[model samples]
Target: MPYAKLTITVPDAVWIGELSRAYPETRFRVLAATADVATGVARIEITGEEPEAISEDIRDYDTVTDLTVFESDERMRRVQVETTVPLLMTSLQNSGVPLEMPFEVCDGEMAFEATIPQQNLSKFGETLDGMGISYRVDRIQQDVESDPLLTDRQEWLLDEAIERGYYDTPRRTTLVDLADELDIAKSTCSEILHRAEERVLKDYMGDEKGARPTVAVSSD
Candidate 1:
């Protein structure tokens, strides 16, 4: 299994792409979407200053057959729309790749993330290329297991450490301060951080031989 993050530049001819380009400041999050061969439906959350105006504009598009605004306010509007299937969605459907929902589109670019089978990754890329879709693969994590890379506790501690500048040059926070803030002992914090760092670095380097260098932690 592998995890991939892609940034796709939606063609301006597509309704959603055109709308996003028209309102560059607005964010369109496709919370849920489903499509067949000819038709597709998506529940999208439009967030910006003028969601009402945006919604109205969407209804004017000929491809969009129906648009229902389920929720609306000054800052956000949630709508479900029935429309002709976009090329990206069609490709995903045909390739049998499960798209992680709640993906975003802003200024005609879509941020897509998915966990895909290693074998299907190349096929997916080829399909996108065949459709003339412009895209960039931002990241790919290969051979990821069913379990997550980091444990919950490790993730929480790592986040705290980074936020506190433990990894910063001329580090702003020490192991003692970090442990104290989390109500854990200094030695325990050090051990947990070391384990977390090792796991992350090893995964990043793809160093199966485990010859990666160790990071020194200040006990102070």
Candidate 2:
């Protein structure tokens, strides 16, 4: 829930080993040590949830001096943990939260999240229910609006088109139908709507153009 910074004196060698073994996830970097290098104070920034949430690690550092914790639980929660992948699509195909593989090992210190489209979320939920799997949807489909390139008018037109099922496989609404409803020329509507649609799909595809850059590591 919050990041905590703890100040404490480094205990004896035995205690140090015990603390390390005890808190596997707690990172203990040496901010500074004693002049003799045995009884110096150190700052231990625990990067995780609240102290109570992750209290098991806190207990080990009972002897830490100037014991203080500084962090904002609210500020931590405000961070938008946006995911680049289509979570629901992946969940449906994979059948669950695949925490491994390309999902990759995340930093224990960082916030975690998943973003899924509304339709995919609903489908995934129904699948889970059908399979008798116990799960809950904690969030809603974040409606990502079309990019800045589209004017407000064009964005509204495109959104209405999608809502009216104009993009459906069966062609739920024809260009003539939309024109009649909006009392506008089909050509003008089509151009605006197409531009809006392109922007939305572009953002969804992770980029409007070109491939993501690759990193090449040198042996040196």
Candidate number with greatest lDDT: 1
- Report the CA-based lDDT of candidate 1 relative to the real structure: 0.89
Q: Largest TM-score belongs to which candidate? A: 1
Error of 2 at 172 (Å): 1.0
Q: Taking the tens digit of each residue's C-alpha lDDT, what string does model 1 give over 97-190?
A: 8888889999999998888887788888888888888899999987535688899999999999999999999999889998999999999999
Clashes of 2: 1
| Residue runs of model 1 more than 4 Å from their true location after superposition | 146-220
Kindly provide the TM-score of model 1 when superposed on the true structure, using C-alpha atoms.
Answer: 0.67
What would the TM-score be for candidate 2 when compared with the true structure? 0.28
Model 2 C-alpha lDDT per residue in residues 5-71, reported as the tens digit of each score:
2111222233333444455454433232222222323333343444333333433444433334444
Local distance difference test values of all predictions, in order: 0.89, 0.45
lDDT of 1 at 69: 90
Candidate 2, residue 174: Cα displacement in angstroms equals 0.4
Residue pairs clashing, model 2: 1-49
